[model samples]
Target: MAVAAAAGAVGVPAAADTQTAGAGGSQQSDIVTLDLYNLTDIHGHIEPVFDKYTSEAGLSHMACYLGKARKANPDSQFTLLGDNIGASPFTSGTQNDNPTVEALNKMGVFASTIGNHEFDKGLDVLKARIDGSDPTHYAKINFPYLGANISGMGTYLKNYRMWQSPSGVKVAFIGAIEDDVATKLFPGTVDSLTFAKPVPVINDLARELKTVGGYVTGADGSTGTEKVKADVVIAMFDNDVERSYPQMGKYVDGLMGGDTHKPYYFTKVRGAEGNILSAVASGSFTDNLANLQLKYDRKAGKVVDSAAVRIPAAEVKKCGDDPQVKAVTDAAAAKSESIKNTVITSKAGKFYRASQEDANHVKGENRGAESTLGGLIGDVMKNSFRTLDNRPIDIGVVVAGDIRSDLATDSGKITVGDVFKVMPWSNEINYVTMTGAQFQKLLEQQWKELDAKSSRPMLKLNFSSNVKYTYDPARERGQRITSVLIDGKLIDPQAKYTVAGSSFLLSGGDSFTAFGDPEVKASKRTVPNRLDREWFGQYLEKNQNVQPRKAKSSVGVSVKEEPLKDGMVKAKVSLRGLSFSGVGEPRVEKVTVKFGANSVTASVNNTLYDPNAAQYSAIVTADGIGHTDTPADVSARVRCSGRAGQTVHIPLTVENEAGTELVGAVQGLGVDVTCPAADGSVAGGGAPGAGASVSADKTPVKVNRLVRTGAGVSAILILSAGLLGMGLSLRKRKIG
Candidate 1:
């Protein structure tokens, strides 16, 4: 009778109650302040970014937030939505996914669903990272990883686990990857398992809670007969952003997740009108935190007080005090220190900040603003792989978005911790084979994409390191690709080409529609997208002397011009940011000039502003090379010859002991070369920059200079370029 009464209290059928209960009636409360904390898509950015020297990163900050949530209310519950891994930066990727999990364990996450990135490194790597005996991968973790819709591995691997709060109320958490995990992962990563739609699997699990006779399911699926019939449902999923599901909010109490870079918090969801529903968004690669609070009542099953939203500064400080949180962060930091040298040394050029007005990094000959960082990362990953797998990679494709911070080649030491701060998640390596048709399709998409305006905002492919390919925007889309090769061998359109990529890409990330081509064939899987993991492993195994130094550097410019009646070319040229040494300062570097594929005079200015005149010119341009007067910086442009039918690409090859980290986006220019028309080809004209014009009526770059001669004696050039560039250079100067 008591069990029946308790079930009725929460709106559940009383007849289903089977457990006997004591007489003292359950306590009920009105105005329950359920604190719901949601942590979704934490790609291992565990640290906090306050300034340069003292930022905490990745699992540390997350753990701190969790500790704060626990204190905010003893009743508060923690949950994660999905996509806590894959496509992570060098830190977790290099480390094999262990330190990240250790930090999560310390954060006290109760439960989570599987996100697409979770499978990026392949299943074996995931398993080893999660359950490895080594301290790095499986040290922490007492929470449950629930996957209901995913079939296979019944007893082989566990399912959704439960976690009971101090109130003895149990929450059942089930995890699910997007139903398309097979396509997203290497063909074999999940060979032993399959996934199902998240909604049905979660609903079925929720119904089973009734079988416990009013006992709520807790972490590890343990059941207990509590007078309160409340159950907290946590579902983690990674799905296409286009497919909206209102039912998820209606059905679950809390959902913290990733896959989409956007954040979604306490917006009122429908089904939870009387209850509470919340979703946590992907943890910002930089600048953000999320929280979810869960509260229960005798009237409603489980209520989400708040979902994926930023934590107050006061709360951040509070969580920082937790011992468990600090420990996890320390471990990651320690592990990060191991691989810091390798990445720094592998950099061919230095990182320059990108302006808000400029396009971010991409993988072309010029490399754009993020090219150097991208190059260094690619080199490190490739080199690490070679050492581990005993094979050299043909080409490497790393997205520019993955590089969160500018590489500090100009005296700002980029440590292992710094690498971790920049790249925090773990994604393993996976290889695939694509037919000539598929390869051509991939290349064609890029050319067509370049021709279209904002057809895809998230398309920046950084192909640096040892990979080589040519993009002739002069040809029609799909046919623009003339050739594809591996190790200098010509690609046969009908034959398969082995390609290396992050598991995320193998499954198709960032709307890479080409990966799904029918002719593609995927190879075996490996562990870690986090380059740092492999870096550390290799360093430790080989125990070689690791030294960080800058490598290559170069400058590129893009100019757009119109043929006037006078026969002289009238055009606009943009001075892209300077690309410099990837690891150390350039031994000897100089920029060359060219005009319409021909030689042109080039000169440079070392100073952006003439203090004597108290005036500044658009930072000078050397002959054709844009070299800034600022030490270790170069940005300029030249008035070169232009021909109506000829377009030339000036390749700024920086030859040093190694590669340079000079990647700048060439904007303010357009390639107007006409391509041969093909059957059913889309019309392309007016160059890519049709509707844009030069608006000098803007104040985007500002300069502030300060001289200091002390222990760290330095002259700081505080040049506030655009937003991206602001994060780099500006405050620091290159030392001679």
Candidate 2:
């Protein structure tokens, strides 16, 4: 450590030689430069990976760059701001990111703050990782994990740490993880830890570091006290650059930020107290390096000026890989190489997980859209149990987050390593034998099952290829799912159906409370115990080649709730969510809309490489219905590049000339209809001779809400068709 301090003194004066003007005496140089290097949101990417960026920072390259910085400034130390590990690629994630810690140790990283992902396995595991106590691996983190504003920290964690520069300038790094970390994590994953606002807690600690050390409540639960000693304070915090709070300049000279993953640098941030601070943030996945240079006036006993920059480590070429870090990386790669390289399917083709692209062509995962990879995983989950039980699994579900990446290989072979990168968490699959009613609730829960919304407003769940559904976002939450069909038949509400999914989700991870409900799991048919990764591998083995499906499993449909006019029952309909927002994806070309007894075909330009959204508008007219009280169903069948979408029924009322809403409530997998109002205003009111005055522009006498008769879908579909066959004029057919 003494050599490290001395090395940092390169091109700097000794402490005694630099002290000047403190007592207004003859002065020497007053400045001492201290350099500190930082990395954030590395996300365990120890291996070199390439994408849109021209260059990539594998640990070896990053080490090389940091090595140069350290040689120039011997007092400098490498620090990580958080997310140094977790949510990793297969090379590091398979071994619980042990290699990442080993690599960091080899690089001589001084300290780090805890990222939200650090708590992915909970506090016990984090402590084990911090203290070299994990039973399976022996690689211990050689440095401390700091979090000043975090409560419930174990003994392995500290609030702040100290670093001394060669010119005798000591820096106190006070750390605070992002304040809203818990919202991004799974429920109950961080129940024991409480995160407070970072800026306020940081100010309080800096106050203590600069003044007398004393007893402070909640500083440590057991001791209720803490005292930090240092000459000046720096910040190691996880924060969004936009919300980093310039107020921190009041007590700290420089700030290091992470968690949002965007790289940034602020040369001068003026605090309320007129002090200036520098802030730096490095981009995610070893893409960038952040540096802070502080000029301390030893005689003045305070920081005078500071500058910071976020270096683009990826672009600087010709930096020879640091041998020590390369050795560590090589060992870790060798440890996971065998299984990762084991070929699962030689004939594997390209498959994609859904994503949304920005104007710059940068892609970010969009969990709201249905992905082909998600569909395939869903198939595997259900098929794994196929024929194993007397009754087949009625449905399978895949959470979008579980499929982390797309599948492709330059060698035309997909390996076990490839699958691990996509599904590295290794969540176990479980079957929940829930009632049909519960399934409906689960489907509606795609919007999140709470009155309050989540950061991601919608987390779309992918269903087995056999399942299809339609919804209307115009409807209120919890009542959005309009139709659900399995194998061309309506889902029976009271029927017991076995649904398979990962244990993480079935046990209520990601806010899916429907699967974790006690009543749903209470069914006698509920089953458990299957590895999701194992099933995926088995599926690849059995299928031999990957077949990509282009059609989306779900679509959005909404019909204007207006009265049917005259002999022609005309209603305008709006449809969307037909396009899959993925690379190399095709949009819907043709949509056959069937409403009530009328069917209409609309052209949607089903062409490959068309840079247009797949959306359509159409009108359905029922000319035969007079003023009866019967309700009708509306839905569409989408024709895409690969296949056709499901035609699930959407419930709608047949309004009368007086604009009275008809009673139609389809429950389960049936076309159930309720009786209309006694007034003749509703079509097919079934009231003795309902009124029949109809015009689109006519003013409505009154508005009646939808009525429910609770008729079974099977009986209604059959009876309606049979009645139309008899030419009884109960409903008319129109096609265009």
Candidate 3:
């Protein structure tokens, strides 16, 4: 069902396949069908690997699949859209991705575009990989990397390349990387390179190749020109299909895109001239191989029909590994085998790195929240570094994106390969001394509104066991964090402590500018000669058995009530919960307070609180009549508005101590309270026209004198005199 066939090539015949009369009334129709094998986001995974679903994934399986497709259709040409290297596993990345390049060469990759990851190391390294100028390899790359929008870097990259099919039809492939490569890449990786607008560059190149033909300058500065024009235009981009499809589709007959790691069997977009353009993206990591078949009318000089098919990795029947590709990957695997197989430790339960479920009832792992795996990694960082450096590590932080995979084996055994896959960056462990204020600032940067208009929300940071913090998503950007405690003690804003983290963070990666400030950078000290993965492995070996601690829930609530004038009471409620601000998770739903027979609800206040504020507060007023005599017991509850739908409650009491005019003030809330009297006076005295001074410990009582003029007053006086005389006569008789 994943494969879609156009013109019924593999199924029932369709009308498009039937021959028709020519435009000039001459019967002439000849179609040339060619197959294009596309792969993207390989990430230099050379050896055979298994996915979380236990399915076969890797370049070896991909090579096998490509071989089968090529055999089935001898005219098939293998191509890589982009992201073939960089951010790779140790097997390939350790060797500068040379093994992957060698494997790709053996698999007969014709051409590819430049992905953002290709610029990970620098432009010079990328050039060396392309030209094989580095001493690692004796031969240059077999395929050319195209970048039509790239400028100012160097002349090694070509804008377009033309390949002539067996049927004598020339196909022009124009390639371009993502437009925002500069933003996504590291600080100085692409400082000298310019990524021009893709649409105009692609359109201009297409026009030149079609009208003026192909021209290139020789190595000695001699210009060589070819008068041959391309019969069909195909555009390949190293960006998301949805972002590049419409523009590329307008000019090209076929388009291929990547970067999202998703597969599109066939997506037909209408062009500017009403012509249908077909595009496809092979999935990432050899999970699936995309096959695009194009039927070209040689005489018409256009692609008449197009179809796409997705061949899953599992469907590639076991034909053993391709000997040529196997030799390359096997050599790389052999170099890493010793470390890969070495047992580091055992886990009591599975440590997840990402979401791995389909059912709604099953809760998937979130990288942005406090996760068991994150906590485990953070603990390893702190404990290992502390042991090695012989210094106290107050806190350890790790970004969720750096953690790549999960430890899902039922056997509980963990290997060096497992750790490598989880942390493939090879980043060194670094330490920086910062004040609590600066540290809190660094934590606040974790949640940011990158785009005001988009739904994409902020990322969360993972902290170690020594750090505990609460955030209120209902609050504004800098004030989201409510409370921060280090080692069970509230952090002092002026106290200085050493923090452990990756060099990436020390250098201010992920917008953590607080870590990169000159003052903070001055205190940075990297652990001598130790990588993050190595530290983790050493820690695991020493521990032998490791299990993640149960992470504390970040949601909390507190309430305070104060008595006001005219039997009115104000309840201040604070909610501490993590929300994605309408991005991934919902915001705080509502906060309600119930006291006696009255219930009141509070809404979130839009005004941002101070950075050191404890919580987001909302005030609700309720009337209290009978509460004047005794203390009022109140309960406050908060609920989240997101999918999790969790809630928290706190009980508080508003007390008016006996003999103190019954002035009420809420207690057990996280905020200070002040009560005012009903007669526009301070409850603690200091009012105008006061009669007598009242003591702090006692209530002030007043008495009124009775008037004897009224009949009721005279009757009360006569009855009181008679009762006194009778009581005296009875006493005298008893005495006699």
Candidate 4:
């Protein structure tokens, strides 16, 4: 930190050092250096890290950064990627992002994408938040809130326009939030608006922006010059570039992404073919800002080149032990000290570090990062819910993606900044109701991906004494499910179940399709500001002896398979479904199946590869497996097996390997495989060989199954002579 300050002294001498001077180096006639400024996931950290009034001071610093950028170049453009609303601290959350918005508004944010948190309170409340102030309602801002790729004036606003520079250069900005925003957040937040996929939506917008002025007329009724279309495109969307950057880059010049809490800058190069594109992500976050310089060649009407600098850390003037940041921070320290000095009660003990080891939800036991940290947060969230209303949380579920860092043994000395670092994104908690069937479907999907060797889907669950579950990775993806209970009763597929989870999962974060069922809508939900901070406060209050345990492995997942090849395989396999009692327990069931498999599965587990049927398996790890009495308390591996056959009935049971049910079944497993050439001929373009077959006769016969002997397949006529003769006779009879 000291080095950064010294470097700043040499690198940034004065406020002028903040100014980004100079026109872009690329002077190509076809290039335009369009500098784009963006902000996202600020999390309402209005003050400096340690200072009391530093929050206001921090605001002034940001202003200085922005003012310098403007002074350096009047042509610079600014946009926001979202998540600037919900999950904020008391300062901004209670005030509904007013200060944050005012700050951005002051700095002239042209447009912003709607983030999932923007809908935390529902659309009406958000609308009220934005419209309450006259400046926001009637600001000179021409940029519209773009969502689902619908642009300008009509879809998000009536202005229906693109920002064109004074030199007649045009650029279109499209806004969109994560698709799951529909469910991951409260329905009240997005009451009626529907969201479409970002790619198609952006493509449609790009087309409109490219062609809006394609036709024009002169006053004399003669053909006039068409309006010059956009030379560059900026998409300020509340989606992560990590997932769709490559594809998204094709339709836009730059993607300012958010909702992931991680800062990212991506540049897409449109290939010789306008559709051909390449993209890369540039990271950004709290205390770190991405400074992007876009050099567009006005003559060429296109961006030639771009550069970005990531500010490693926030610049805050250091203070002595009584330093303001330290002072404010010390106050909390002093409280802990005073409490310790007054009474010598039983040691709270050091807070435990959660790793992939230990058992029990007990405070002293070691556990996986997700279990310990996630559980702690869930408890706090559940408490928050209780504080807000009399109704207690039925169950709390959150994906591992939401929790960025693990609690460490040394974390007992946690600081405000440290807490913010762990829960950086500050996503709001959302609730949705799903049926038992849908819940099972969601689990099946999770297993398919995780067992297939992708990322594991770990969710924090706070069950309401009514639900319990058990898992068996011992069988195949479909068969790994077992033992579900709800309200002390077995789960029923037809029953409705209430589930608590973040907006991300309900929106399919883990590819859990069942949760996205239209009927699985949200009910009572609250998007609290700074869920982690609130939880941290509660954690400190409850436990005095906090410590983190050493990390170790707990849950283990292994996949067996060969590298998979392209194409669909037709085979049936039974898969276990998850369910809870009261909601009815989900169970493993026999199923008929035919599906496509991904190549990544083969790459991960080549031994489990099925030559004929597409099959894959993988191993996943969950910490603290041994000692949990929690309802969903169990662990085992799921096995997936594939074989060559015309059709196979794979039983979905809690077993360790493929069963012997098909031991004596039919065994003529020869597969009819062919890779027809572009010319529609067999490989090598030769006549049918001994084993390979083609038509022997020129006349085509209607045959369902043709047998191959040598040279060609023996064709059997399905329309027998008798049937043909009978048909003729029927015609004759009609004539008579």
Cα lDDT tens digits for candidate 3, 1-736: 1235322222211122223332222223467666777888888777776545434456766676667655554446777888888767778877777888888887877778888878777788888777778756433566788899999757678888776654455677888875666544555678788878776788788877777777432323244565677677778887655445556534577778787554555545665456677777776767666766788876777777887665556554354577778888889999888868887766545666423111111122233444556667788777776624587788888876567556556787888887887787778888888887787788777664423211113345677877765443433456434446677566666788788888876667656778877888888887877798888778778877676553232333332333322223234444332222111222233334344344444443221111211112211100000111112234322221221211112222122111111111121122211222334333344442244222222222111111222222110001112112211111100000
Tens-digit per-residue lDDT, 127-214, candidate 4: 5555553454322223335465423213333211356543345666667655555445533445466555666666567666665642
lDDT of 2 by residue, 547-601 (tens): 7665666765544433333323334444545545545564554455555555554
Each prediction's TM-score versus the true structure: 0.52, 0.67, 0.67, 0.52
RMSD of 2: 12.0
> For residues 1-736, could you state the per-residue lDDT of candidate 1 as single tens digits?
0000001111111121112133222334422444545556666555554543223334555555555445544556666656665545555545655556666766666666666666666665555545554454444345556566777745324456555555545555656655655644545677777666665665566555433423445445465556333366566554422122344644466555555444334344544224445554433442334544444553655453543345422335434444665575566657765555643333222443221210111111111223445655555555556413555654555654455555454453345545554444434666556665565566444321311221122234544344433322222234323223344344445665555556566556544567766545334345454444345345323422333324322232333333321222233333223433232323233333322333222333322221111011112111111242322222222222232222222222222223322321221112222211223111233222322222132101111123222233222111112111211222221111
Q: Give residue 225's error in model 3 in angstroms.
A: 3.3
Q: Which predicted model would earn the best lDDT?
A: 2
Candidate 4 has a TM-score of 0.52
Question: In terms of lDDT, which candidate is stronger, 1 or 2?
Answer: 2
Model 3 lDDT on a 0 to 1 scale: 0.57
Task: Give stretches of model 2 more than 4 Å off.
Answer: 1-41, 51-56, 70-78, 120-122, 134-136, 162-174, 177-284, 287-318, 357-359, 386-390, 448-454, 474-476, 522-530, 557-576, 587-693, 696-736
